[model samples]
Target: INGARLIMVATPANAHGDIAEQLAPFLKDDQIIMLNPGRTLGTHYFYNLLEKNGLKANVIVAEADTLIYTCRLVKNGLCRVFSLKKELHVAAHNPDDTQMVCELLSEFYDVIVPAESVLETGLSNLGVIFHPVPVILNIARIEEQSTFSHYKQGISPTVATFLEKIDNERIAIANALGVKVDTAVKWLNRIYRTEGDTLYEALQNNVAYTEVLAPTTIHTRYIYEDIQTGLVPLSILSKELGIENSAMDCVIRLASMLYNYDFYLNGRNEGIIDFQKIINSRKVAISR
Candidate 1:
């Protein structure tokens, strides 16, 4: 890691903090640390962690809105890649470093593209709209150990409609914070090149989702990881910006009940992230 110029963190969102603490001691100045699919506000959380862990290196921390590949583990030591995204949006913690980070990353992946800022990448997290709700809706089948495609079978027309409502609330929060982010429907088309008038249609049209299977148990990352790292921060931001977030709130509350855990208390909030700093940074980036 010390010898590497570019360090990519591809772990689940929940593990980011631990990874940050472990890497802080060894991180070198001018090195780049990128979170693959930062979920939401991931780089912010990680950067803060690094600082708290006594990191003195002037490293550039960046995050991607999504992973470059739609892949899954086939078995131990084996993985299957369904497809690679034609384009991927990445942004640095400091907006000024975004282009340099993208340019450096492009040597490894030509598909990399610079995003407006970390706010855009955070708000553009599609997994916040896609992952958790379906699992909650399909709890019965999942508990019964019934096999089904996560995107295709789990997300019915009705579930998809509800998911869109969640997406609408997310976009509303982004708008209130002065960040321009793609709606889930638009993001699907851009990433997968799947055409549809609605998010449900676009998801169904995405061939990459065909082989993705739903978790058979409740203790999956769909709920724990997405709710903790993705939806929780969105809920916090919506409150800070005075945006109505009943849809997000409902999901959070339901997830709490299902898991018998208070996600809000353990997840990112005002205490973990400075909401005003995030808002101010986005405003400054917009002015530039």
Candidate 2:
């Protein structure tokens, strides 16, 4: 880690802060740290952790809106890659470092592209809309250890409809924050080139999701990771901006009840993020 020029943090979102804390002492001014899929506000949260750790290193922190590959471990030492996204949106904690970060990352991945800022990359996180809802709605099968394709069979027409509602709320929150983001339906079309009038149709058309299986247990990253780092932050922003996010709120509450854990208390919230600071930062970035 100390000798690496580029460090990719690929752990679940819930562990990002811990990873930052661990890396703080070893990080150098010239190094670049990237959160593979920052989910939402990941760079901000991670930077805050670095600051709290009293690190003086000027390491460039960057985040991607989503992972570049759809893959799973096939065995102990083998992995199966379903597909690779044609393009990926990436941004740095400091807006000015975005291009350099993208350039550095491009040497390894051609799909890297600069985003407006972390706000754009964070709000553009599609997992917030895609992961938790299906798992929550299909808790029965998951607990029973019933194997099924996550996107294909898990997201039925009705579940997909509910997901669309959640996606709309996510878009509305992003708009309220003065960031432009693609709708989930449009994102599917853009990322997978699948044509559909609705998000469900587009998801159904995505062959990349064909063999993706649902989590076998109730304790999965879809809830702990997505809710903690993705929806929790979005919900917090929605409330701060006075936007109605009952759909998100409901999911958060349901997850809390199912897990017997207070997600808002444990997840990313006012305690971890300075809402006003982030909002002002976005405004400053936009004005430039």
Cα RMSD to the true fold for all candidates: 1.8, 1.7
Per-residue C-alpha lDDT of model 2 across residues 96-209, encoded as one tens digit per residue: 889999998899898998998888888888888889999999999998899999999999999999988888888987787688998999988986899898878998899978
The reply for model 1, stretches above 4 Å from the true place, is 284-288
Model 1 gets an lDDT of 0.88
134: Cα error in model 2, Å: 0.7
**All models: lDDT?**
0.88, 0.87
- For candidate 1, the per-residue lDDT at 160 reads 96
The digit string of per-residue lDDT tens for model 1 on 57-110 reads 999999998888878888999989877878889999888899999999888898
Give all TM-scores, in the order shown.
0.93, 0.94
Worst 10 residues of 1 by lDDT: 278-287
Q: Give the clash total for candidate 2.
A: 0
Steric overlap count per candidate: 0, 0
For candidate 2, the per-residue lDDT at 75 reads 98
